[model samples]
Target chain A: MSENIKNWLLFILTVAVVILLSYLANSIINRKAESQFAYTPQIEIGAHEPRNVVWGKNFPRQYESFMRTRDTSFATYLNGSKLRDALGEDPRLVVLWAGYGFSKDYNQPRGHAYAIEDIHNTLRTGGPTGPGTGPMPSTCWTCKSPDVPRTMAEKGIGEFYKGKWADKGSEVVNPIGCADCHNPETMSLQISRPALVEAYENMGKDIKDATHQEMRSLVCAQCHVEYYFDKNIAGQEGVPYLTFPWKYGTTVEDMEKYYDQMEFADWTHPLSKAPMLKAQHPGYELFTTGVHSQRGVSCADCHMPYQSEGGQKFTDHHIRSPLDNVANSCQVCHREESGALINDVFQRQKKIKQTQLSLEELLIRAHIEAQKAWQLGATEAQMKSILMDIRHAQWRWDYSVASHGGTFHSPVEASRIVSTATEIAQEARVKLARLLGQLGFSGEVAYPDISTKAKAQAFIGLDMDKLNDEKETFLKDLVPVWKKEAAEREAQMPIRPVSSRE
Target chain B: MRFSSLKKKLLPPPQWRRPVIILLGIGAGLAIYIAHIANVGSYLTDDPTACVNCHVMTPQFITWRHSSHREVATCNDCHVPQDNFIKKYFFKAKDGLYHSTIFTLRKEPQAIVMHEAGQEAVQSNCIRCHISQVTDPRTAAGVSNHAENRLDRTCWSCHRNVPHGRERSLSSVGFHLEPLPVATRKGSFVPAWLDAQVNHTSN
Candidate 1:
């Protein structure tokens, strides 16, 4: 064949093959789109169904993935899915929260699946003999279960809050699950917690106006953000109303101002005599000020990344630290190797932890100094300023470190909060030193040897032996009964089975 | 008119471009020849070995070789549609194009996840292949009930590790990719122009 004819033939063949492939590809894409949209749903989920098993019948993929949260094998440097005793790791926390329930016991939070079980096991709740006897209010159960929303719907919201933690044991059976965040009808993320909506209203912002991306984080904020039980809200008299102190804002100073305005003190510091504030897990609040949040990354973006199974893409509902799934979580956006990304998180945590320890040591000294001043017969007038300083300083420290992932979430902001707290602690100690000098005791008040949790608890007058025995009894006796009652109650609830289509 | 004149001026003479065109044609032919030698055309067949051409697919290929379905099916049996000739080839062609694009770009993620389209095809194939077992009265009642009420339960949704057991480490099979010398991989490796812009903002 002539060169011209040969070239023309070759070009024609190439073009023809390309066109054939293109047509094939286009048809396949169309078929795929059609098939995806035409799926016949297998089960109908009821509105506000708290039982995950019912929802799982419809979304077997999502539900099966969600059940993986029960696997407590993963662990990282600072945080992971494993159940860890936080107090056992850091005895300084006992001194830091001397008068609070947290000082009795605190565990590093595990996965969402363990939320209910962890709450039951924590010694902070104490061994309540019966209803209305526990130190914790019914509001304490607000974050632990999807059943909280169900109970609130069945009973009046006001009536739900008008009880003690022990009273709601059998009622809040199911751990945090689908109904806590998702609307059953559409499976869209929704804030079921009224406290979050009320907090939004307090800030003159309607949560309804929040974008879809914002809802990803807000659903987490339902339980993860800092909140307190307000027993004094108008018309909710004597009921422990769950409230987020975010009206001023979510920043440490913003929340301090809000708390100061309300004159709210969680409890008096036993050592310092300061009207102290205890920080709940401020994960959402701290995360909002983070670089990821600033760049529009939601809590779910890391904690609940999308996973592909078989051929379906759905949210992985096992809510745990991003550190555990660095490849899926951080490495999706970051180009770093898995080890490198993990190292980055660990380094940030390490740096923050160094400062956190220093702040804790300083606060311990301030509390001891304040105790010395009181012992030396310093007037209430003389100690008032010191007490306020201690309260503010400890509040800042607690706010910085209490938010589980705050250090890595916003290292710069976490550092700033800790530094300010350190300064306040030093200032408190300095004033306490002057008071001690004035009262004719000029020598240094030696730091207590609280190098262990047992030692620290002893220093703080916590009878650990009695507490542990009581907890053992409670777990052995009461927990089984509660489980039986809950199982029986759930068994009574009818599961509306879908009629078969011929 | 001015733009067309500029374009003409920028173009080389037809006779002068003949050698360059010939060289380009030779390069294209060589690439096609290499691809054919690699058995790229065999991907259109039911042979599962065709899926193992790239180094990235080594783990998957090895796992699938030992999988329970190895005797009964190939990769296409689950992954590609088998509804009809046109639909089957169409699905294969679309996936082939996507796989080639991602491979050529060197943008394969560490963990390979099936796309939504691939998932649907797999789900459909599962139902088609195991129709009797799936539609057994006891099993069908639960699954069909779910399908009637909410969304059809894709078989692989519960059996995630069926075809591949669980994805073993790529390193275990002596599979690794040489690191790409991309600027985005590290800030220090960025081009002078980008580095200048970055530093300029800082200054």
Candidate 2:
């Protein structure tokens, strides 16, 4: 009886150990599979594929989240993903940009999915009824789509930027998508635009040395940076070449010094006639000065944070304001409740806006003051120093505001720039007072009645009625043809299913 | 006989008493020496220079001095609790202890950002001073939370540049001599003398 009992116990213990071993082996295998980011290819993505639908077949989750860029419901205190009529909101901007194309119609940019459509619809494109009709160069399409890189590869960089913006309308039909910032094969972050590489080259640094983390922000910097159309490159004359003014540095003072030395102007202000500089979106440069960047946080760290969906971890692609998802973005690093974090951002923005608005008022007066100086028979010699001051003052103001997130990114820097601009503008007024006395008319130049967008535009002598009429015709007649042509061309490409599973 | 009696009463035997007196005297002297070296007394006053005694705070002091609030306020006014005497000293003592430990260990992070207790004091001070500006309906934090769990808003979240410039990094640590830094290194992070002393002691 004792022998039987011992045998039974031994048998049961062996069985239990075998079961536990199998369970451990199964878990190990499952974890290995998950770590591989396992996915089977649905269709082979072409090396130069620009159509997002082709990539979507293999990456449904990423593509679906990316498509949420179509949503325009979100708005914030100052800016948003909505198609906001900026000039309508603040007429003073119309006078500030006087002779620039932005003055014609400057809408705060909508979602990235609307990139191609919005550019085609804006009046600033100047009614491209047929090819080569718009005022802007083909360089305007540089940031609009992945198709730009593909087109540049085929047509060559200088030639890609040689023609009018409308000339490439049929070709750049797709809005910004996957190929703009990714390697097709490995899906690693990559810079598709040559301008960014060239800018880095000019800065005496190699873009190749950037780490995977740095590449996350560098990809966004490829488009969201201050750039100019350098028309006088040694071999690429009249190409309206895209160039970043970083030879000196990325600061306002540095870029201003570079532009002044080169005698480059975006457009001559018709009202003030000061050689003007349009501050393009310098989002990346301004952000580097903030506490976020100093703490080694990348743009994607906040803008495209990691999301786990269906047991798979990937960067969330529905990029918009951080205020929209403060829990996932700001709250990840900041322990302050969402309300506290947002209140902080709004406070900084509102405070900066107060000084910015004051700068705008001062700028309007200076322009009118200079205009008065010119009208009262002030000679070019006398107006030279005064015009330089206006240019410097206005450049500071634009640099602070045009970066869009500068107030939140680096409020101290923005505040300092605006406050200094105010001082320079007051000095311009002081010099104007002296100059006007010599010209024999010193009565305070009557402030123009620019109480509304229409009045402001009219004060700046813009023919908004004609511009709107042309825009209507362009959108109704030409845009559809371009879209249809692009669709037909894309449909011809073949996408075969790969018979392999990873 | 009188002289011998006076000597016996006034002074103890040299062997044991001398050493005992010496040990207690050394202990008290060392305590006062540390107190003087740490500039502990300055922390009790409203002087901004007391902060820069730690070289890590040089940048914040320089930035504050150049700010618009330089004429009006000092570091303690915004950072220290001001409800009453007891709470104020208690908070300072706790904070100073933590800071000294971190600095001595060379374990401070690059950013040197504030934590909960520091944040609470600053928030209360901001609301106290700028009550009118904060109470404005347009900028005020409303009672509604939209189902989101969060604490109420603080002023510095918006007014980031108040008295101190926005920088909070070790890289911003300037080498200003005035106000007399308690500790300064000329070459590497650990001064040559300190490195030599450490090696000698370890050996």
Interface RMSD of each: 18.5, 25.7
What are the lDDT scores of the predictions, listed in order?
0.76, 0.78
Write model 2 residue lDDT over A51-99, tens digit each, in one string. 8878888777778888998999999888878889988988998998998
CAPRI quality band, candidate 2: incorrect
The true-structure Cα RMSD of candidate 2 reads: 20.3
Clash counts for all predictions: 12, 2
Residue pairs with colliding backbones in model 2 are A344-B157, A348-B158
Model 2 lDDT tens row, B79-154: 8898898988899989988986676555878667889999999888876777676566554456455123223666
Worst 10 residues of 2 chain A by lDDT: A31-40
User: How high a TM-score does candidate 1 get?
Assistant: 0.67
lDDT of 1 by residue, B46-84 (tens): 866567555556566655643446557778888988899
Q: Quote the positional error of residue A497 for candidate 2 in Å.
A: 1.8
Scored against the native two-chain complex, candidate 2 gets a DockQ of: 0.01
What is the DockQ for all candidates, taken in turn? Answer: 0.02, 0.01
Runs in model 1 deviating more than 4 A are A1-38, A500-502, B1-203
